[model samples]
Target: MQTFATLRTPQTTGLPARSGAGMLLMWLGIVTFYRIWVLPRLGITLYVDEAQYWTWAQQLDWGYFSKPPVVAWLIAASTALFGDDLVAVKLSAILLYPATAWLLFVLGRQLFDTRVGLRSAVAFSLLPFVSGLGLFVSTDAPLLFFWALAILALVRATSMDRWRDWLLLGVALGLGVMSKYTMLAFGASALLYLLLSPQRRAQLGNPRLWAAIALAAVLVMPNVLWNWSHDFPTLRHTADITHVEGINDKGGNVGEFLLAQLASLGPGFALAFLAGLVVAWQQRRDGRMQLLVCFSLPLLAIVFLQALRSEANGNWAAPAFVTATVLAVVFLSRLKTRWWIVVIALNAGLMLTVYHVRDIYRIAGKPVPASLDILKRARAWDVLARQLRPIFAAHPDAMLLTENRTLMAHLLYELRDMHLQHAAWKPQAIPQDHYQLTTPLGPEDLGRSAILVTQSGSAGVIERFSSHQTLAHVSVIAGPKLRREVDVILLEGFRGYR
Candidate 1:
């Protein structure tokens, strides 16, 4: 698509012809390959949260305690064909990464110059936080994709005033809600925008706008019902974590959140995001900038308020980052080429720094190391899983008990899915299936010959199981990104006639 950016006059075009759609497509493809083939097959192993989601996939629920089931369903669908290996388990997110880039491209082209559009895609593709989020099998991947789609659709609806476009916006928002409850913030923001902006408020009278809202409600109704049936446990769970419980302290304070955001978005880009906001305001004379402001402001306000309440900084307003990146592309393009090159260099430096730092902890040997000290970030459960496989294979009747989901999924894949002989294995028995060791177990549940898999971090809970013996001692790295405080350990216990 030859646009203003590809023309000979840089003043009107504002972007090099060399930085066209073809170049952007090539970058997208390379990123797709790296995420799908390079990262998953590298055997980074699942994080505890990832493992928990895997467990959810097995149960196939509409919603879970902490999030909706889209991620679980996605993982389950991918792993079913891929045979539950690391690559298969995480493949779905990798494939979706490029789609996210494409969405950002559309958003950029619509918002700014063609150069800005292509640069936005590249910026999104390379953002350390976005890249890291994309590789993992988490709700965020799907949430980001759906949110981008919603933004794209909303842009079209705002521009074209087409009923069909509004319908698409509703569907996108609905799916996003299904993906992550945080999307409710976006929904609320949209409504607030409509109510506050006189121009947008006019849409309230439009049947198509109402139809979009109705469509979104209808799509999310099933999960809402599911939560209702489950005592709205997810809402309760989120509330508990965010308010009732002190886990909020563990997530990050306001200062930490600000710092983390800065780290995730390099200093240069972060500054550019701020600058872009100013530029958008100047252009707000144009209704388009108002759209960006409307999309971004409410979410930022909510997150900021939540921060005051001790909400984890990351959770405050993650979706806002994409808008920030888009804004950055717009501002950076107007700067001298030398200055633009400096910004790109800064981005490359940040990525390389993260890559190298993550590489040191590659337990399976990195196809490409992110950095040194990666082992410090490695999770200890990886090694323990390796040792438990043979023991579980020998005693097929014996059940495995894990305190957390990550360890639980690791055992499931290692023992039941791979390595072990599966002649006629039925699903796991009760307590063995998927019990939360974070809670206590009674005496009636004791004295069973079970492989009690518990992590050192949470070993205090299982310390009282006197009837069992520690059969093996194993350890794995913490992770490339997280701190290595306590290595996760697995304890095996056998019931004895005392």
Candidate 2:
């Protein structure tokens, strides 16, 4: 096995000196403080997805209808320690980025120089997408962290042929898959790297590599079994998102998807990433550059083609940027420092604006129009919950009912303290989500008086009930802009599911 000293070039041998270490530590502290303190106090409510994940955490499932179980498990762990508050729900997301940054630094330094490693760490930490992610708990947090770790482990395993590193790589891959299925893209990139590089190709015969594969397979087996038992709902959800059922055989959406990537990554980092790709291509003769490109480009191309065939999300290509961040810094560090600094500043500013968007508009004496307020969905749930609290107290025996999944999810979290017995009014046979699958109002619920809530005025549900009366009509000012109204009606005495 190759030693750590043997892996370092002259440029990196002395590069982990006090300055680099100190800089990394400083940045980690700054980011940690901001996420833990500033972000939680921003007055922004949890988005529907966040609330859904929180509800999932309470159940501690091995799988979900739309995603793997890792995110729910993460939330469960955090809330266990912190007592199930919003901060607890989001604590893992707040802390994961720094771990990701540190791993990125280790990988970058091993592949290139210490300066390149530091630059890449900073660039990744400051990425607009990452900054946004820190404020919200999602599957992406653990996914990105393990993705970087897998890359680091793979680089070490390939360079040293160490069983330990290979084993660690397997662990990272398994957990990454649990976080989000996109981790398969990293596996695809790794396969391409081995096929393209003569030196790495030898690893195909190494038993350690096969052992790694087996380990990852073993770790992911439970989720696979869960999916199989559940009719492969996760796989079906993935296919549905890709729009495979209604393929546009002739027209591709590559151009629009690329534009979305630019907007998501921020223009400066996107440009730097493109330049890095060019530089990596020109330096293809160097094995390290080839390794980076092999790990980066294939995923981008695959998603780009997917976009071409159907549609792709902006964040679908996110893991590609992990290696591209290092490549970008390596290329950008050659120029004046001002270039990278300005880009970092712009991203930071954008992050701050997102965190304090309501305050910004209020200070400027302007309302953030409903159309422009990205956080509108999160705003009015609590207000609705407050209005329903009295009604819930008055009719303690009546079960709360709603047909909308979003409403059901938010109400589950908001009224969690009340221990509300709620169920989705699934009139149809098909289950749309985990809530519908688990909490349907079945025959057992028939003849039980219920409090029915609906944004659509309950025209369809009224006839099915034994009798009903208008309890209250609520018009909530949703969003920071306060320009839109979310009107909900509470229908009392909904006596039957029929």
List runs of model 2 lying over 4 Å from the truth: 1-8, 12-15, 248-256, 480-498
lDDT of 2 by residue, 183-213 (tens): 9888788887787767778888989998998
Error of 1 at 337 (Å): 2.5
Error of 1 at 181 (Å): 0.7
Q: Record all residue pairs in model 2 with backbone atoms less than 3 Å apart, i.e. clashing.
A: none
RMSD (Cα, Å) for all candidates, in order, is 6.3, 2.5
Cα lDDT tens digits, model 1, 286-336, are: 555565666766677666656666666474477777677777877888897
Off by over 4 Å in 1: 1-11, 14-19, 40-43, 195-197, 244-252, 313-316, 357-380, 418-434, 437-448, 456-467, 475-498
For each candidate in the order shown, give its overall lDDT on alpha carbons: 0.65, 0.80
C-alpha TM-score for every candidate: 0.81, 0.93
Worst 10 residues of 1 by lDDT: 421-430
Positional deviation of 111 in candidate 1, in angstroms?
Answer: 2.7
